[model samples]
Target: MIYIPKMIFHGNPLSFGQYFYDVWGGVSYWFTSALSVAQILLAALFLSQRDRMTFYVGTCTLLSLLGIYLRNTLPSPFPWYYQTGMVSTLLMSLGGVYLRYESRINKLVSKPYVFGIAAFVYLSYVMITNPAHPQGTTPDICMYLWKYLTILCSIICIIALSHLLPQAKWLEYIGKNSLIFYFFSGTMLALFGSITSLLAPDTSYILTLTVTSIALLAATGIN
Candidate 1:
């Protein structure tokens, strides 16, 4: 934003009077601002209402739905599910759903095989019903269902594995640093694009990816 005064725009993030040829480059300022504020409030409510189960669940559900809205309405060329507002809401909703039925869900997810089977089923379904479309929404009900399943299944698989694994100190450490590593990874990715372009094309992509991954890992490792 500080660079906006000088008319500098990279990837043309939403800003006044600056637009890129790509459809994704343009965004309504009011829409973005309103959504951002609403999302922040939703998140705060979710966190502050932690002790009240009913309120927590409601907040979670709202957040998750907000995430869906965020993705579907995003400018084209943007990564689906790329916005933080939607993601926060989605995660909150997931957490709410999980906590609401943790006892019952635990009984089923205790078996690691359940996760394995679920993951297999999800992949198989996707493969069998391969639909050709750009990286955005479709009128097909199956498309939205696929998105829900993919995200839910992944979280379920992770939870199942975590439950099955023996407790380990290293895993605990990594989990603690996950947020720091996540934030760092985004910044490094932006920087890497410019830095990596200077290298020879043949090896640049591979080297860039390798270095980025290593840097991310190091950030997590040392955090």
Candidate 2:
């Protein structure tokens, strides 16, 4: 997966799909993606059972697959709508797992405050060092840390929110069709980008970002 980005940056001629199999220089990205999918499936199976350890392991596996798949699947030129569909599916699945086994998870973590503080601190670090921020110019020491922190925060947030909101019935319903949202995000992003680019080829980044945000909100509403 890392190799794909490297090759793309280095001007590799292969199309996005072909690059997944370009293993002459190293591990084929395609194989990595496949392995990630298999891991997700395994995690889903584990989480579906009543065992807490199995559930934890499986959830991690599924998320790892999602990260890998998202990075590898550029989904550009296609409407951002498609991307949304995919993400929606993933989120919905995770939500379902939470709905079914959150109580068991809370028992295992047993220290919400500790996890919450950790997540907050990590989120702060990420905000401070994000590449988009002025302070982020110091070689991105916190960039990698931020990625891990965000993942941790996401898990903690989900658990905490589940307790507070307990009515994830709606989220669970949405989760059931998360793939549709994922697909929508991609398609919408692509469509919006294409139209905007065509209309404003020299548009500023800020403008593009604003448009993207608006598009995302609209897509969310649609979902």
Candidate 3:
């Protein structure tokens, strides 16, 4: 579908290699994000072994930091290992494993609000100071740092907020179908151009957001 439009409208024919890379090779993170749940379950097998669990988490934490550092420091077009999101999967999956035991950690269970507020504030600070920019072929170290901090902080905030709003059925429904929304979101975004093309070139961001949201929900529902 993507290839046909570029060839017909843009008069730019994408080679098979390019199309494969664009659609699959470069986007391993999209799939790995979901597969990380499998990794979480495997890690849970060691729940009874305290020493091994601590070692695994500690090692993954260090590897996560190392992966971030290497990706930032290395030349453009990072190695397949870095691009495949192995480090990120380990980080997130291990974090999930740790969260299973969070309730037992008296400090975290007792003062969840404090941690949540701190995460919110730090996330706000990063958003303000390190405003996102397009990550080109060779992005800066700050871009890598910004992404890591934003993800970690966002996760913390979401986990904390989940405890407070545990009974929102609407939210639960949305969460249940999040993957469906994710899968079709790009198609909706591409379709959005038809609506935007009818309006002024400099349409407001709100209009784009509104139409995209409606189109995505409609697509999800139809699917």
Per-candidate RMSD vs. true structure? 6.9, 10.3, 5.9
Model 2, residue 164: C-alpha shift (Å)? 4.0
lDDT of 2: 0.56
* TM-score, per-candidate, Cα-based: 0.54, 0.41, 0.62
Candidate 1 local lDDT, 11-113, one digit each (tens): 5455433433222332323234334544666667756756666675566556556556666676342322235444455555556667778999988877768
Q: Write the per-residue lDDT of candidate 3 for residues 85-132, one digit (tens) a residue.
A: 434655564575666777654346337676666587676766566547
- After superposing candidate 2 on the true structure, give the runs of residues whose Cα lies further than 4 Å from its correct spot: 1-36, 40-101, 104-112, 127-129, 132-150, 162-173, 196-223
Estimate, for each residue in 15-118, the C-alpha lDDT of model 2 and write its tens digit: 75654335432234333334344445555565667566445545554555554466456634122223323333344455567678878867754576866686
Q: Rank the candidates by TM-score, best first.
A: 3, 1, 2
On TM-score, who's better, 1 or 2?
1
Which wins on TM-score, candidate 2 or candidate 3?
Answer: 3
By lDDT, rank the candidates, best first: 1, 3, 2
The candidate that achieves the highest TM-score relative to the unseen native structure:
3
Query: Ten residues in a row with the worst lDDT in model 2?
Result: 77-86
Question: Over all chains combined, what TM-score does candidate 3 have?
Answer: 0.62
lDDT value, candidate 3, whole model: 0.58
What is the Å distance of residue 179 in model 1 from its true position?
2.1
Shift in Å, residue 105, candidate 2: 3.5
